[model samples]
Every structure is written in structure tokens, then in C-alpha cells.
Target: MVIDSLLVLGGLALLVLGGELLLRGAVGLARLLGLSPLLIGLTVVAFATSMPELVVTVAAGLEGRPIIGVGNVIGSNIANILLIVGAAAMIQVMHPPRGLAKRDGAVMTAATLAMIVLAFAGTLFWPHGLVFLLLLGAYLVGSYVVERRSGTTEPAGEAAEALEAAPQTWLPAVGLVLGGSVGLVIGSELLIEGAVSIAKSVGVSDAVIGLTLVAFGTSLPELATAVVAALRRHADVAIGNIIGSNIFNVLGILGVLALVTPFEFTSELLVFDIWVMLAATALLMAILASGRAIGRGTALAFLAIYGIFIFVQFDTGFATAVQSAVGL
Candidate 1:
């Protein structure tokens, strides 16, 4: 048990370090190519930070543990909003960009709803995966066009900060990206292995393990990014990272995993967790639309809810009682 616990911790550390290296290198490379910081934040940095989720989900799918992949994405999406954003906001009030509140925020809510609809379909097949990937493509293209039309060429506040701290040369930057990718792959493998073992020892289901342990472990990068950005007074970066990461987890990671191997939806997820995720997203959107920063009070509320969420996932007796009550 101790060995497994240590492995999980070690894996999480690697994931955090690896994600930072990957983001720094990728941002530097993008800057060298003259890409706008906003574009890098939306695409490169967002995708880079989400690498841990992508790697873990793909690994789970390949290992015939589809529940782990599905649950990880669902759980990560929830944590991205409640845990990451909440923790960040507590550091400093997070005032997201108005355009993000209107545009990217809507896309995030839509994606969450879409996932819930697909969950009820019983299974995610290749065709469903293709549709999701197509949607992601369209979203990227549409964002590009809109930003261009608006002449919004500035880099994301976070991306600009990252660029300032990145290596100034191509060789070291390329090395960091390559090295980070390798480390992330290795770390995810260790994490999944340790988590599966621990789950078995603890008599928990793969879905439960995925939703709690694996999900939280993989989300560390986003947590670190958001908190750092908030401390730097770059609220847009913190909020934008959460929104972009959530979208990628659903549309990009899950979509690709389904393409490689189809996965069935767990009834508990469809009945409870999916709705919870959607509710969180909706609440976040409302907060953003209010045009006020996510204050410490709201942050505390988010953290409290997330605490209940984690508790519910672990407390099978309570979950069972709730499921029975809901006729799930």
C-alpha cells in the first residue's frame, strides 16, 4: 500500500514538472514562429497543459480500462472549474476577458451539455468521436476567424508571462518539448498503474478511482497554472486556462480516446456526475457574465462544493443511498 501511494505521488510530481516544461517549450517555439500569444494560449498552451489528461485517457483506453478514460475526462472537467478555478480565485480575484465570457464560455457549456447527451446514448463509438473532433476543428477555425475580424492579435496574458520566462533559443526549447513529452508519457503510465493497483487494494471501482485519484492527479498542471497566474495578477490567463482545458478534456481527449476504443457510460455518471459537471459549468458562466471578478467568497463556496463532491465519490454508502433515492 505504501509503495503504491509513493508511486502515485511520484507520478503526480513528474506530471507537474513535465507539464511545465512542455508548456514553456511549446510557447517559446510558437513565439519564434511569430504566432500571436492569444492563439498560443488557446491552442498550444491549452493543449500542452492538458497533456496529462490526454496521455492518461489514451493509456486507459489502450489498456481496456475505458471507464478510467471516460471518468477521468468527466472528473477532470469538473475539477477544472471547481477546484482549479476556486483555488486560483482565492489567491486573487479572477476577472476573465469579456470575449471569453461570451464566446469560449458558451462553447464550454455547450460541450458539457453535448457530453451529457452523448452519455445517455449508452456508448461512445467511433462516429461519435469523429463528430466531437470535427466540432473541435470547427471551434478552432471559428475562433481564429473571429479574432482576426476583431483585430485581437495580442497574446493571452498568461502566454505573454510564460514567453517572458521561456528559454530564448530554439535548440533548448525543442529539447524541453521533447523531453517533457517523454516524461509525461512515463509519468502517466506510472500513475495509471499505481492507481489501478490502489483501487483494487482499496476495493473501489475503476470509475471511482478515475473520478477521484486519477482525475485530481492529472489536473495538477492546471491547478499550478491557474494559481500562478492569479498570483501574478493575470486573471485572464487563469480563467482562460480553465475554460480552454475543460473544452480540450471533453472534445479533444475523450473524442480521440473514443476513436481508438469505444467506451460505455456508467449509469452513476449519467445520473449524477454529468449533471453536476453541467451545473458547475453553468454556475461559472453566470459568474463570468456578472462582469465581476470571482471573489474570495465565491471561491470558498466552490471549494466547499468540490469537497462534497470528492466525499460523495468516496463514500459508497452515501452514493448508493442517493442513487436509490434518484432511481438511478
Candidate 2:
């Protein structure tokens, strides 16, 4: 157990470091390739940052533990709202664009609903993955065209902000890209192995570990990004980053993963966790619709809810009771 704990921690560290390097290298490569900043931020940066989750979930599915991947994606979506956004809001009130709820939130909600619909049959296949990918592609292309026509400056500015710490030279960038890819592969294998070992030792399902520890560890980068954005008073950035991550978690991570290896969601997730994710999504929409900034009080409430959710995931009896209540 102790050894497994160390493996988990070490794996998490590598994932973060690896993800950072990957982002830098990929961004540098994109910039050098003459890609626009908006294109880099929307495509390369978004895909790079999500690599950690992408690797973990896909590997899990391939290894016959599809539940872990499903839990990771679903848990990540919940945490993106309740944990990452909440923590960021604590640093400063997040004032999203007035139209964000209607536009971006609608897109996110549509993605969420799509996930639910795809999973409703109690299984996800390559066809489902195809649908997700198509939607993601359309979103990306449409967003790029709209932003380009509207002359949206935020993505370019955000790209510049992202580029500030990245390597400027091609050699270092290429090296980092290769190294980051290796790290992510090794780190994901270690994480899955450790998480499975710990789950067995504790008599918990892999789903439990995936939903809690694995999910949180994989989300570390997002947490850091949100926190930094909040500290810098980039509330929209913090909020937008989280929202974008959530959308990608479904459309991108689960999309490619399912195409490679069909995912079989666990009974645990099919019952309660997915609904919690939907509830969290709806909560964010409600917040956005209300036109109220996410202040400290709201942040505290979110954190509290996050704490409760984590606790419930680990308690079979509590989860059973909740499931029963829902079934009723």
C-alpha cells in the first residue's frame, strides 16, 4: 500500500510536469510553424493540456477497466465546476461574460447531454466516439471562424500569456515534446497500476479510486491554471478555461478513448455520479443565468459540495442510500 501510494504521487507529479512541458513544446512548435495564436490556443494548447486525462482514460479503457476512464471523465467534469472553479472564485469573484451562459454554457450543456445520451444504453462504442469527435470538430471550426470574424482578441492575448513561459527555440521545443510524450505514457501506466493496486488493497472498486484520487490528480493542471488566472484577476480566463476543459473532457478525452476501446460504465457511475455531473453543469448554468459573480460565499459553498461529493464516493452505504433515494 505504501509503495502504491508513492507510485500514485510520483505519477501525479510526472503528469503535471509532463503536461506543462507538452504545452510549452507544442505551443512553441505551433508558433514556429506560423499558426495563429488563436489557432494555437484553441487547438494545440487545449489538446496538450488535456493529454493527461486523455492518456489515463484511454489506457484504462484499453486495459479492460473502462469504468475508471468513465469515472475519470465524469468526475473531472464535476470537479472542473465544483473544485477548480470554486477554488478560483475564492481568490476573486468570477465575472463571466453576460452572454457566456447562453452561448458557451449552452455548448457545454449540449456536450454534457450528449454524453448522457450516449451512455444511456449502458455502453459506449466507436459510433458514440465518432459522434463526439464530429461535434468537437464542428465546435472548433465554428469557434475559430466566429472569433476570427469578430476579431476576438482574448484568445490571441491568452495565447501570448501561455507563450510567455514556453521555449522559444525549436531544438528545446522538440526535445520537450518528445520527453513530455514519454513522461505521459510512463506516468499514466504507473498511475493506473498504482490506483488499481490501492483499490484492491482497500477493497474498493477501481471506479472509486478513479472518481476521487485519479480524477483529482489529473485535474491538477486545471487547478493551477484557474488559481493563477484568479490571482492575476483574469476571472474570465479562469472561468473560461474551466468551461473549455469540461467540454473537452467529454468531446475530446472520451471521444478518442471510446473509439480506441469501448467503455463499459460501472453500475456505480450509471446510477449516481453521472447525475451529479449533470447537476453540477446545471448549477453552473443557473449561476451564469443569474448574472451574479461567483464570489467567496459561492466559492465556499462549491468547496463544501465538493467535499461532500468526495466523501460520498468513498462510502458505499452513503452512496447506496443516495442511489435508493434517486430510484425512489
Candidate 3:
């Protein structure tokens, strides 16, 4: 038992570390290919961060555990806001950028609403999945086009010049990218496996596990990235990472899971978690558009809200435990 727990912890550690390394290398490569930082944040970085959720959901769906997949998506969205953003804000005041408030805020809200609507449909079949994917593609393309039209500068030239001036070859860069990908995959796998084991041991449903453990686990990368960005005072990356992650948790992970393995929608998800997800999304929007960036007070409010949510979840679980103990 101890060995299993250790392996799980080790796997989780590997997964987060791997994801960070992979994202750095991937972002560098994207920049090398002339992608603007904002576009990279929206597309490349967003997708990279979503990969763990994608892997966990897909794996669960394929294994006939639809609850895990569904729970994972819903849970992840909640975590992105409550845990990731809250933690980042607590670490340092996170202010939303002007573009974030004016544009991405609306986009994130729409995506959240779309997920709720899709959840009610009872199945994430190919048609629905395709629609989500198309929306994601459109968003990416639109962002890219806007970047180009705005005459935004690409950091690729600087990166390439730096590489040329340094005593380095393409081989090292290629190795870093490959290594990062491998680490992310392996780490995510181990983390998911551990999560499932832990859930079973704790006598919780897979859905709850997804809601608490798997969701938070997958959001670790976001937490780290956002907090670090916040400390560095890069409001755009800090806030962008959170908002972008929320979008991908719905559109990216859910879309891919539906296409790969259609999940039977749980009405419970609609009743409880989806509303929580939407509420969290709304909170983010409210904070961003309040005409002032998120400050210490806002962060405290988020943390408090998160605490309430967790308390409610635990209360429900404890009630179930009591009921079971008394044969209710």
C-alpha cells in the first residue's frame, strides 16, 4: 500500500515537472515559428496546459468510466477558477488586462455556457464534439489573424538570433521538446492512475475524485504557471493562463473526449457541478470587468468562495457516509 502511494506521488511529481518542461520547449518552438506571445498563450500554451485533462478524460472514457471523463471536465473548469486563479491571486494580486476584460472575458463566458448546454444534451457524440472543435479552431484562427492584422511583433527573430549567436545546435532544442512531451504523457498517466486508486480507497465515487483530486491535479500546471507569472507581474500571462485554461477545459478536453469516446452526460453533473463551473466562470468575468484588476480583496473573496464550495462538497460527502453507516 505504501509502495503504491509512493508511486502515485512520484508519478504526480513527474507529470507536473514534465508538463512545465514540455510547455517551455513548445512555447519556445512556437515563438521560433513566428507566433506572437499572445497567440502562443491562447493556442499553444493553452493546449499544452489542457493536455493532462485530455489524457485523463480520454483514458477514463476508453476504460468505460464515463463519470471520470465528465467529472474531470466539469471539475477541471471549477478548479481553474477556484483553485488555480485563487491561488495565483493569493500569491500576488492578479489584475486582468484590458483585452482580457473586453474580449477574452466574453469568450470565456460563452465557452462556459456552451459546456453547460452541451452537458444537457446527454451525450458528447461526434456531431456535438465536432461543433466544439470547430469553435476552438475558429477561435485560434481568429486570434492568429488578429495578431497578424494588428502588426504584432514576433519574438521568433530574437529567439533565432539568440540561438545563432549561442554555441548551440538544433539537436538540443529538439531533445528538449521531445523530452518534455514524454514527461507530460508519463506524468499524466501515473497521476490519473493514482487518483483513481486514491478515490477507490477513500470510498468516493469517480465523479467526486474527478471533482476534487483529478481536477486539481490537472490544474497544477496552471497554478504554477499563473502564480509564477503573477510574482513576475505579468498580468496578461497570469490571467490569460487561467482564462485560457478554463476555455480549453471545456472546448479542448471535452471536445476531444467526445470525439474519441462519447460520454453519457450525467444529470447530476448538470444539477450540481455545471452550475458551480458557470458560477466560477462568472466570478472571473465579474472580477475582470469591475473596472479594476483583481486585487487582494478580490483574491480573498475568491479564496473564500472556494472554501465554501469545498465545504459544501464535503458536507454532501459526509452526509452520504453517515447514511451508508446507518444503512439509510
Local accuracy of candidate 2 as per-residue lDDT tens digits, 218-313: 999989888877888886676777777898999998888879887766666767888899999999999999988898998999999999999888
Better of 1 and 3 by TM-score: 1
lDDT per residue, candidate 3, 240-282, as tens digits? 6667667777777788888887777654555566788888887
Candidate 2, clashing residue pairs? none
Per-residue CA lDDT of model 1 for 25-119, tens digit only, reads 99889888888776876678767878888988998899999899888988898898999888988888877777677889999998988988888
- On TM-score, the stronger of 1 and 2 is 2
Clashing residue pairs in candidate 3 are: none
Query: Best to worst by lDDT, what's the order?
Result: 2, 1, 3
TM-score (all chains, Cα) for each model: 0.94, 0.95, 0.85
Off by over 4 Å in 3: 31-39, 154-169, 316-328
**Which residue pairs does candidate 1 place in steric collision?**
37-155, 38-155, 38-156
Q: Stretches of candidate 2 above 4 Å error?
A: 153-158, 319-328
Best candidate (score: TM-score): 2
Specify the poorest-scoring 10-residue window by lDDT in model 3: 158-167
